[model samples]
Target: MLFQILLTLSIRFFLFDFVLFKSLRNHLKTKGYFFRKLLSCPFCQGFWSGLGVFLATHLIAYNLSFLLPMLSFGFVTAYLSMMTTAIFYPLIDKFEKNYSTL
Candidate 1:
């Protein structure tokens, strides 16, 4: 049980902090809005984004797993990371703009 929880948390943390966030940073940099902002808070935004992605992916994965029992952890992790990043990109962009002015 503890292992499962830890694994879940680790996956969420890594995906959010590394994959999703790095992608956001790169995209923002490309857009010329690479300012550090306290708007909405990065950690807070990351936590909420991670939690939302975790829940949504779990539900989707559960349903899909029922149909195909070999979905694999890697696929789920990547999918969740991509989904969360896509969802939060716009919000982060807005925050980046806010941060630049300050």
Candidate 2:
């Protein structure tokens, strides 16, 4: 579970926050404004990315009990991962700024 949280944070910070926006900037300009806006925002991107990571973790850690209650556990795990990513974004931003100067 802890590994999943950390992996989600890394994906949110690197893939969604850095690579996607930078690499797709030109392409997004010619695309729908809403799609561009959604991808550019870290929080929005993080939510979806975290959910993705959660799904991957769920697949790896699958157990019969995890689906006993209609997949509620998976949903809750993903939501929590997303929220944690959002909450730590500011700190991650600061770290990036500092690291870039090193």
Tens-digit lDDT track of model 2 for 1-102: 667656766775676557335657657746998877665665556556656776666544557664553254345545664676667768868877788666
| True-structure RMSD for candidate 1 | 11.4
TM-score of each: 0.34, 0.51
Q: What lDDT tens digits, residue by residue, belong to model 1 across residues 1-102?
A: 234334554555554344346766555545543233312234443444444444545545556644342233334444554555577778867876788566
Clashes in model 2: which pairs? Answer: none
- Those runs of model 2 whose alpha carbons end farther than 4 Å from true positions after fitting are 19-21, 60-102
Backbone clashes, candidate 1: 0
- Model 2: weakest 10-residue lDDT segment is 66-75
> After superposing candidate 1, which stretches have Cα over 4 Å from the reference?
1-71
Candidate 1 residue 50 Cα shift, in angstroms, is: 13
- lDDT (Cα atoms) of all candidates against the true structure: 0.48, 0.61
Best by TM-score: 2
Error of 2 at 74 (Å): 9.1
